[model samples]
Target: MENGTMPSYFYFTLFKDFVHMRYLILILTLTVYLAILLFNVIILFVVFKERSLHEPMYIRISCLSVNDLYGSAGFFPRLMVDLLFDTNTISRTACFVQIFTIYTFAVWEYTILTLMAYDRYVAICNPLKYHKIMNSKVTALYMALASLYAVFSMGLAIFFSARLPLCGTDIARLHCSNWSVVRLSCGNSTLNNNIIGFFVSATTVFLPAFFILYTYVRILIICQKISKEFRGKALQTCIPHIISFVNYSIASFCDIALSRYDSDKFKFVALFFSVGFLVIPPFLNPLIYGLNLPEIRKNIACLFQRSKVGHFPK
Candidate 1:
């Protein structure tokens, strides 16, 4: 251990263990990664280009898609390289960057979900005041606050994890996470490292999740008193949000699982769980929202039709 820095490189035993399935995993990873990119990018493009889709709810959904893309890009490129090649190791600085990007993305995933839930609540429960509550200023403020909150919360854990002198070089997981890095720190003398890491993540992740669930419950109760048609509309919107939350929860659960049960027996299982959160929601979100929301589906169909009509002879 050195005073100024930790290990120069971290070799992932998780990737190393996938000797037989490396190529298979690489193919699958590439497919899912591409899907994530294609889907989220379309959402962003459509949202920005179509003036009709520029409402607060659509804007919030766009931000979530961007967050998902950012998260997928942070991990999948590095991970795909490892899967296709033998370079299971990553530079310490690069590892830290991944840690920050991924954790911040995860934190904001929850934050954005919380805000989306609030947006839905207002749309359903206080329809007349929706615009008043979710004005341009308010929408921007929600996003800014979510980013800042994620940074302060996850940044604390990363700070604790990064400042410590790592005693080992091998991380048992596919990517560099704060917990994996913190565990390499030698002494249990301080309360700052792992303890704070867990506390920071638990609070940051769970509190937002609890809040999202609470908001949905209220939304559900309120929907019951409304007309059946309106209730169906609410379900159509909220179902995707719930599914995305579950997607994220599964990814977070994978982290805990790997830390507890990293072994040869779980290598294949680990590979599936490791990439699920990053790939699944991004890959599915656009499809979920696009297909479920009538306005988006209609806009997309019109977009394609316009493209088709433009290509024909005048």
Candidate 2:
């Protein structure tokens, strides 16, 4: 490593010890990757094909499925290749691209989830004006803004990270992260990186979290005044979103913890936390939304029935 020069490649030191189980892990990884594609694509196809399921909430779910696909693609293919070949090295360009893609997916996910919360809020708290407030154009605009913000924020973070000069190329985990790369810097850039990261996290993560809380609180207050029947309906709509949000939050916390305090003594736990965010959300989101929302569930059923009928030559 030279001063003020980035490493040509990064090595995942953790992968060295996992060579004996590479084949088994490769099979499992392939299975999960394919499942992620299948489930998220099913949601995407159902949302787009069924016009009846084209509400803002369903639209956001479709976006989430797309984001899941994007995020999974960033890691799974490269990971499968690494597993199959027992290689732990990733080129610098590919590494940072993965970082940017993963970060954007995460930030965009919360953005869409926040939008969904606001949609639920309007639908429940301001029923009569829901359509006017959340029309397709408005939804599009909100998504556009969110996408821009996700890209800009993560891009800036990557920009800052890329400026630092690396002194080492060994990453302790399976994947590349901004923090991991920043930690490799020979200079005293950690403090400055922390400050930038904090501000970025504040706007991209915490602000959306607080806004979601506010929307739910308002929804709760409105539900209390309304009849029990109405309350049940409102909560029914919210439960899936709530579950998805909490699931993501927990996974995110695990990643944060792993990054901050990872150690060889707790390698297994560290491994789980490292991949939890990528795995859990992609796996569970479709299940949560499909099973919980009758409209989506019904449409998905209809889609399968149609495929079955078409396949049987009826």
Q: Name the top lDDT candidate.
A: 2
- Give the per-residue lDDT of model 1 (tens digit) for 142-214: 7888788778877777766777776688777788877777767776633666577667767778778888888
Structure candidate 2, residue pairs in collision:
none
Runs in model 2 with CA error above 4 Å?
1-4, 311-314
The lDDT values for all models are 0.80, 0.89
Error of 2 at 187 (Å): 3.3
Q: What is every candidate's alpha-carbon RMSD to the true fold?
A: 2.7, 1.9
Local accuracy of candidate 2 as per-residue lDDT tens digits, 233-314: 8999999999999999899888977897654778778777998999999999998999999999998888888888785212
Alpha-carbon deviation at 229 in model 2, angstroms: 1.1
The TM-score that candidate 2 achieves is 0.96
